[model samples]
Target: MTTEIGFVFAVLGITIALFISDKLRMDLVALMVVAVLAVSGIVTPAEAVSGFGNPTVVMIAALFVVGEGLFRTGVAAAAGNWLLKVGGGSEVRLLCFLLPVVALLSAFMSSTGAVALLIPVVLSMARRSGMQPSKLMMPLAFAALIGGMLTLIGTPPNIVVSGALKEAGLEPFGFFEFTPIGAAILLVGAVYLITLGRRLLPARTSEQQTDHCDVPGLMASYGVSGQLHKLVVQPLSPLKHQTVVEAALRSEHRVTLVGIRRSGTLLSSILPVLANTRLEVRDELWVYGQENDIERLCLSHRLTHYGSPAKEISRMGREFGVAEVMLPPGTPLQGQSIKEGAFRQRYGLSVIGLRRRCEPLDTDYRETRMEGGDTLLLAGSWERIRALEGRRDLVLLQTPAELGEIPVHGSRAPLALLVLAAMLVCMTAGWLPALTTVLLAALAMILTGCVSLPEALRSLNATSLILIAGMLPLALAMEKSGALAFVVEHLVSWLGGASPLLLSTGLFLLTSLLSQFISNTATTVLIAPIALTAAQLLGVNPEPLMMTVAIAASTAFATPIASPVNTLVLAPGNYRFSDFARVGIPLQLLALAITLVMTPILFPF
Candidate 1:
């Protein structure tokens, strides 16, 4: 082999090692690969950076904004609400509502976001319905991974492979072209999870359960329940202008001030009440009080009952609620103190409590440096809480059961729905370029105030964008250094005599295995070109083989490390690695069977 090809192969090995080691982020590993390639002269610097400008990259970024619009405007949460309503109290019935909607939504947005939005819902389902969180968590993660197979934009791998086809001068897969096989796989998975797969999942104790958590339990443990209320100070109120302590709120009103929201400011404008924080006429007070005393105090003092009572937490969840958000490893929040981060103004949530190593920190977490695995208890408008789904910096650990009952931006849901519909119609009917259609929809979402510019910007996933752009260089390096041809020739030599179905199965197995250990997007980028080359050698259509690779890359079910979706559930479900393998292997094998059987018929190899 030529030195250039040798260098390419060496870099490939190192990249794989880095991915398997889990010592660094995948996106960072990709950048390392790009730097190595550029320094080694495998690809020119211009060629290395060309991926940033690629239509696929641009489209993926645009898609994030569109998905964020849906999320920010509560389109996704609305779907979750529907699932809850339809799911009722049965685990089996919940799965029926859950798997399909999750798959449908993931077909359009980020699978991680789809799963994140539903994680709390699933947990709530577990609490209310007496089902093991284990049974529901795995099913939810698996369904989301499978959901990525349903549309061209369903997952990064789908987009990568489609881009590969386009690069080969073939028409890219159409929007919804993946629906048949993907929907079929989802159907198979649903049946498996409901029947045999449910049995395969272990009935492990949930972390929430083991930790003695629930809305009531948390309220009791924290010693802040019926005590929580919202009160608005009237202009002529005797308490106005008095410092919280000076006002004798504890002695007279029998209330303790917790937080204050000023009128004519955003929800983020809330200020925590301290000993010297003076109350204003229009200030809304978050206080702790006895129900009878609070009612009497408000009536006598002319204070408006601005907040929902603790017992009415569910009824009030639409306007406000509490949740625990943990900073998982790699969260950007690490190293920044809560106050320094200005997290409240940025995220519109107040830190009501902070816990480290399962122990509560001092009441003042303001100056505490946030670290990975530290959990923060947040209280705010449910809409703001729902918006937190887009923040990769936080893993929502224990949202109250009431959170699921809350509707977000209900008034704007219809407009968001219309924008989503328009985008889908344009893509489905070929009324505009797919990329243009998505961009327009995203723009419409902003112009119509469905999602603000900052919210749109916040929704852009830098790791995904950078990962795709960085790995795109590998495709260029492989092609330019004769490495792709070398690999494809050997692959053809080994399987040249096999039937197309066998070849397809082999390809599927290869892609699925790699995906189990690394980013599927990266796997697709490296393998898709080879699939196209192998199809050329076999004298068959490349579409089937390429499609097989795309579908297989999404079968990241067999390992906890396979996909973020899987990892996100590991701690929450109290799962062992064996749990993933036991439940995921069968699903992977089943997906492989379906892909091998269906690809040829769909694409006609």
Candidate 2:
């Protein structure tokens, strides 16, 4: 190997080592690769950063916005709900319904997002059916991974491999090129999971199974039952006709106004308690405070105290809800009390209760200093609670089922669906480039109010995007420095004169093994060029080899850390590391066997 080839290999080794160690963030490691490549003259500075402008990067980013539009408009959640209704309470029936639906959804959106959105729904199903979450969680994750095999835009690996084809001056894979093989895998994998795999799932339960609590249960756990009271703003009352800020409820009366009920001529609507929400006569106010403080406020403002509004609180699910949010380690909110942070004014959610280490704090939690690992129960409109899912400072643990039942943009679902369909049709017909079609769909989503611009922006996973962009330069460096040829030559020599099937098997095994430890997208980026080179050297079809590599990269099933989707179900499923191996190893092998047999049939060498 030449000196430049040796250096590029060194950079590749270090990147793999860092990814396997799990000490530093993947994106950080990717950035390090870019810096080293640029500094070593393996790639020009402009080429190193050109990944940010790559059509693959832009297309993936646009896909995120499109997925967010679907999520915000309840397109995905509706499908999940449909599964519950059709599957009923039987474990077998549920798997049959869940695996295909989740896979199909994953084919269109992010696997991680599909899994995250359905986790609570699946948990609810398990709870209602009296089945163990482990029995279903692993299948949910594995199916999502398999679903990515079904479409070109299903996952990053698919996009990466397709981009590889385009970069090599070949016609890229069609939009549905992966469907036959992907569909076959999903069908076979679903059967395996339902039978043999289902028998291997753990039956253990964990705290996550009971993490979500109903409104009454949450209040009872937080010991806030006695503190919540309802009062009427009587005519001529000092608080009537005044905004919440003008009345100074929290500052002067030391009581938190949770929400206000305005009884209109046709119906009663619950208004989120904002600083500018003006109070009118006969408005029912849900307030939280000590009994003495509440009494003082009621007497001073000429309000009629009506004791606790338990019924109203239960009915608050229509417009209001509660969610549990935890402050992750190193959160910026650390060291500041809720009051000091202006929690309500900043987030538009009231911090009603706090828990440290799973134990509820019965003290004045509002005055308690925020700390990492602290779990706070927030009460507000469902819209505000939903927004917390995107915040970096706090981890949104659970929102009540009511949150899913009510879509924030339910009216825009049709528009979102229409845009998605049009984009797919255009791409499949080659009416526009894939990236152009995706960009137009994302733009339509924003213009039709399916998802706002800020929401679309927030939906983009910067880590994945940066990791892909930063690592693209390394792929370029490998190709530019002859490192890719070196690796391919060695691989071919190792399988000298062997059939193309043997070569594909080797590529599949290597890709699958590496994917279990690192980001699948990164793994695909590094392996795709080598696969392409090997195919060219052998004078065989590169399409089958590329398909094999893409499928193998998604076999991230044998470990919890394999994929974010797997990690998502870990605690909820009460799974041990071995539980994954027990089910995932067999599944990975099954996928390999299926891919090898089917690839040649679909795209002959």
Candidate 3:
């Protein structure tokens, strides 16, 4: 190997280690690779950074905004809702309905966005059906991968492979050129998942199931019945002039005050009792605890037993509810305490309880520092609880099922759908390049108020764009250093006497394995040229080999880290790394069989 090839390989090795370790962000790891390649003289500074200007990077970034427009306008959620309506509560029915629908949506927009939009819907289904989220989540993620095969714009890898063909002076693939094989794979995959593959998926429950405790559930689970009792304080009551803490309700009697009910209008009807809240004559204290303890405290304090507190509190639940909010990795709320972060004031939700690492804490959580993966039970008005869906800092893990409808952008659904359809027609009809069509669609989404500027900007995934840009140089370096040619020469030599099917299968397996560890787009960019070179050596058309590579690149189903779509579900599904391999290996084999059989027939050796 040449010295430059050695250097490039070294950088690649380190990058893979970083990716598997999960210690550094993938984009940052990719950027480090670029820096090493540039510093090591494998590529010049301009060439190293040239990927940032690549059309693939620009197009992918623009698509992020377009996908965001669909999400913000509730277009994606509407599709997910439709799946639930048709599938009802059957896991088999849901999986059958879910896989195809998600695949269809992914054909047009970002697969990652499709998965994100459907996660809540699928989780809702899983909870209602008593099925583990793990069972449904992997299927949701796998279907997205299969969906990318259904169209030219389905994924970046397809675009990269097509762009390579164009640059090679060959006629590029038509927009729907990928549909035949992609649809076949989607059909086979959907079948595999719902039937045999469904049996393979592990039944692991999510933290949202075990750790999310609302007020009613907590009360019932703890057997704290009849704990809520209202006591009326007389003028001569011992608690009349004391503050809540000074009254020693909790310290002396194990009784806790929930709120204070006073006379007159609704504004002063009930006030949330705080630490410094003072007690006064005729103040109705809503205390919760052992019935005997509360009665004893009431008698000792010259207080009169009043109405039922549990009934009154239960009525408050009509307008109030509890939700579980999770601080996922990369959330800005990490490292800040509840009090310091002003979470209650900012979100209008009170943090009533917290669970860290699946262990609930009885101690006050207000001063506890927030960490990634921490689940918090929040109490607030139903409206405010629902509004948490719009926030990005924390994920709303669960809400009342009644409030699960997709939030729309006010009569703009038709406009958003129209814009999407126009973009699709233009791209499919070859009226413009895919990049131009996506850019125009994104701009239209903003202009039509389907997405705001801030939302559009937020939608642009800097990590994905930068990762693509950073990894693009590795392909260039491999080509320039003759490393790519060297690898292809050996492969062709080994398979020289083999049939076309063997060569296609070999390429498919190689590409699929590499995609598991690296960005699939980068994997496609590297493997496409090699596959084409091998085709030339065998005196066959490069289209079949190239198509095999494209299909294989989308088979990133074998690892949680294989695709962003998978990573997005890791915490939500409570899946282990082994869970993916158990399910993905069989799917990969199935895809390989379908690709090897179909590519040769479609393109003909």
Kindly indicate the candidate among 1 and 2 with the higher lDDT: 2
Among these predictions, the greatest lDDT belongs to 2
User: On residues 308-358, what C-alpha lDDT tens digit does candidate 1 reach at each position?
Assistant: 754344434446666778889877778887666555557766665667888
Local error of candidate 1 at residue 237 (angstroms):
22
Clashes of each: 2, 0, 0
Candidate 2 residues lying further than 4 Å off, grouped into runs, are: 87-95, 102-184, 191-218, 224-268, 271-316, 322-406, 499-504, 510-586, 595-605
- Give per-residue lDDT, candidate 3, residue 235: 93
Which 10 residues in a row give candidate 3 its minimum summed lDDT? 264-273
User: Considering TM-score, where higher is better, how would the candidates rank from best to worst?
Assistant: 3, 1, 2
Instruction: List where candidate 1 sits over 4 angstroms from the true fold.
Output: 89-93, 102-184, 192-222, 226-312, 321-411, 499-501, 510-586, 595-605
- Colliding residue pairs in candidate 2: none
In model 3, what lDDT does residue 481 have?
Answer: 80
Cα lDDT of all candidates, in order?
0.75, 0.79, 0.74
**Residue 318 of candidate 2: its Cα lDDT?**
55
